[model samples]
Target chain A: MAEISFQLLLLQLMTGLALGAIYALLAVGLSLIFGMLTVVNFAHGAFFMVGAFLGVYFLGLTGSFWFSLVLTPLAVGAIGLLCERFLVRPLYGRGIDYPLLLTFGLSYVMIESMRVLFGLEGVPTSVPAELKGVVDLGIGSFPTYRLFLIVATAVIIGALWLFIEKTRYGLIIRAGSRDPEIVRILGVDIARVWLIVFGIGTAIAGLSGLLAAPTRAVNAEMGIPVLAESFVVTVVGGMGSLPGAVVAGLLVGVVFSMTSLFAPEYAELSIFVLMAVVLLVRPQGLFGKAGLMG
Target chain B: MSNAILSVRDLNAWYDRSHVVQGISFDVNAGEVVTLMGRNGAGKTSTLRSIMGMLDKRAGSVVFNGQEILATPAFSRFHAGLAFVPEDRRIVPGLTVRENLQLGLIASRARDTTDAMIDEIAQTFPRLKERLSQEGTSLSGGEQQMLAIARAMMAKPRMILMDEPSEGVMPVLVDEMFELFARMKRNGVTILLVEQNVERALSITDRAYILDQGRIVHQGTAAELLADDEIQSKYCAV
Candidate 1:
């Protein structure tokens, strides 16, 4: 019994980390949009969903998963630009709840439209030949695809950190995240900054969808569940704190992975429990700073 | 010196229907540092906001450089050679001093201001050069004020609308601000300075407007306003 429990812990940890990578990416994207535009981005899940759908269709037709990987996010990002130009721009200064609703409504549109085309069914995506097979860790044998996913997430995240902290444009993003009004005074078109951020954020969400498509059964409903999970991780980690999201993602992932050991039924709710505790402990989130936006 | 760069006529503004700026009017001429003087809530701030068209709703005829500019949006107004620095200071806390200054030049893309042009402005505010890499919010009250002025000058606007440059600054720094405004005047940038310090305002401005209860109660050469104790006692005095 003890050996079985230990093995379960190990397997869940591996599984959770992979899912957590996707969640962390989604949370980071959500936070980026919030940091720049002050919008909660309820449409995020829809963007993620779009990435997955595009990944499957494009990869299957072109027989190039990598090509789909590059195109899907950029295409979704363009859609995001249009969304900002039309729906989001008009809603600026109208308060947080308004954009939240607007994105939320937009989410349904994106999902239903995809649903109408694809029908309500789950689609399975196979791993490419290059990433297939097993990677042997000292404890056990893990799929190479899972290992690749983890490494890819790390590299992408590392690149993002550098882009945000090191580059000149990154500095603007960080400044805008901390203070958009100040960003404006320095003569930056606040709208232009917002548009870039919106594009990058939706692109990240798209990437999350593309990355997850192979691992999970793809369906229109896939995005909604991941969206809820990502928000749980975001709230748990700290809203608008990039590092916090990373930590929270890992923590939530581990907890969920561990909880499933005892009961798969309660696995989903474990992160929410952690979220409630985090909220109780730190209302501003782990790294959230107040008045930065106002 | 008396070429009016910016002028407002019968300007009325609102924050969602409550009238804040009640048809007040004034003029700022080229290369002149004119102070908008008032107590708190006297509409001095709104007048400046209206000049930049920052208000959500407003009715007025604003003419900048002889062109009627009442229809211009806040973002477009920068193209018309107007700059606004708000009371909050609005320094991006994480961005270095150089980044803050460069943004003004980058955003405007005006002829006089570029990244290299900002370096020239940096020479004028040596404190900025010393702390070029320092995050803007990290600067002291005086240094941040200097940075704000430097960033504003990146555009080298025909005029600058500065809201309350003296407020929240320490006593020692207050005098330095006066000297900077003086230097700015020498550089040929028309400036509209808002201040609570009546004596300083009178001394710094070429011309002055004393706003009382959302209206201009007095307007004259700075010396004339200083000598009139009745206007001083009623409106300018603490």
Candidate 2:
């Protein structure tokens, strides 16, 4: 066995945290959609893939990473809004299964459409010069982009928390998540709220995808693995709980990273293991209310 | 008929094939507190819900302010100035008392004046004023009920359809709620209340209707209903 140094462990921990941040971003969006709309968005991963492709398209057009970063989420979010209006809205009150199935099918359509338009090959994104290279920590050196990812995600999550906890629309979203019928009776156009929530949820997912592009391949099938892993994060955190998604995401990320360092083969398997243990121990997830899904 | 703010004619409603409100008819005049008193499952709540457009299957001529609203959606019905305070007093979890009150103005024309409206409403319910920052659901049962009523008032509604506000509340708070209703009546706000506390409800009501098995079995002035103990025991028995 190779001797592990303290610096190496710290580096692995930082890497894990960065990975976890991305997972948290994706998982939180999933949780928000589920919480507000009560629809399991199978199309989330596809939205992520769309974001990356949009990033590639926009970056190629402007040769500016910043432009792609700003444009991808807006474009993808608009797509999400349209989807909510046309696809998801019709299926509500018909029961959860119809929307679930509709989104399941929607994911396939998104993936196939991307494949047809962009071709089957994976696209690569180069990190911006300002964010490239390594920064020296007292313990060791870490990539600036990775640190930037962590900071950017933290800022975005903070903003999202403020939106949900402080703003009036956020109040509606929170109340609507708990009892949509009551919110409706209060004269809120609940349909509009759902539309905006889907837009916001997919917009965040799109942002995460763009952020992931420099580190991971941008391909038609790219969202598949991330999608599966995010579902684990969401379940472990508890469905429909925002804070739960964030905490569980980071935990899963660190666990996966540590496993990757110690036993490379078990890295992916470890996420499932963690999920299974959490389910057996606390079925509602760490922050999820009991019987919410039911 | 001209003075009636809410006029219901042959209102029928169902809950998944079980007809809950069978052709129930009633009229609530402007600036008067009207009560619908009944036993459990007597369709009192159903009648209110149907008027509020909450029931999916219903047939009725519900003319609110002279506009037939049976075909409009629940939210639109609210936009037409019909506020409903449900029986459960659903104080939303994870929301503060201030936020709970904010829910009342979310879709109202008064939404732009949220803080001012809250301050104005807080003066009336002193209990809620002290706990504006506290989570709404964490409050005691009575406080939650107050929050629900205060929330409905935030809409600045022309009429309020209150469902069992006195249910599950402390006797002291029940008295407070009735007192508030009396004050609202004095201020010229129309009210249609569904209550299990027959005597307390009748004390403040102008007229009372007793429902039995989805139909109106008795309708009379509050004084007449209060004097008739036989009608109360026969229809509103626990």
Scored by CA lDDT, what does every candidate get? Answer: 0.81, 0.92
Give the per-residue lDDT digits (tens) of candidate 2, residues A104-180: 89999999999999989967777877799999977799999999989989999999999987888888998999999
Q: Name the top lDDT candidate.
A: 2
Instruction: Output the TM-score of candidate 1.
Output: 0.92
Q: What local lDDT score does residue B192 receive in model 1, on the 0 to 100 scale? A: 88
Candidate 2 chain B lowest-lDDT run of ten: B102-111
List runs of model 2 lying over 4 Å from the truth. Answer: none
TM-score of chain B of 2: 0.98
Q: Tens-digit lDDT track for model 1 on B1-238?
A: 2467887889998878678888887877788888877678888898888777677788979999988877765666777778888887777776788887866765554634466786788777877888888888899887788777777778777788888887788878888778888877887988888888888877878999888778888889999988888887888654
Q: Taking the tens digit of each residue's C-alpha lDDT, what string does model 1 give over A1-294?
A: 345765556866887787788888898898888877889999999999999998888888888988887888898899999999888999999899999999999999999988898888956788887889997776688888877777878888899999988776887787777766656545566788788889989999998899988888889888888889888877876678888778787778778877887777898888888888888987666777653432
Worst 10 residues of 2 chain A by lDDT: A121-130
Q: How does chain B score by TM in each prediction?
A: 0.93, 0.98
Candidates 1 onward: DockQ, in order? 0.49, 0.87
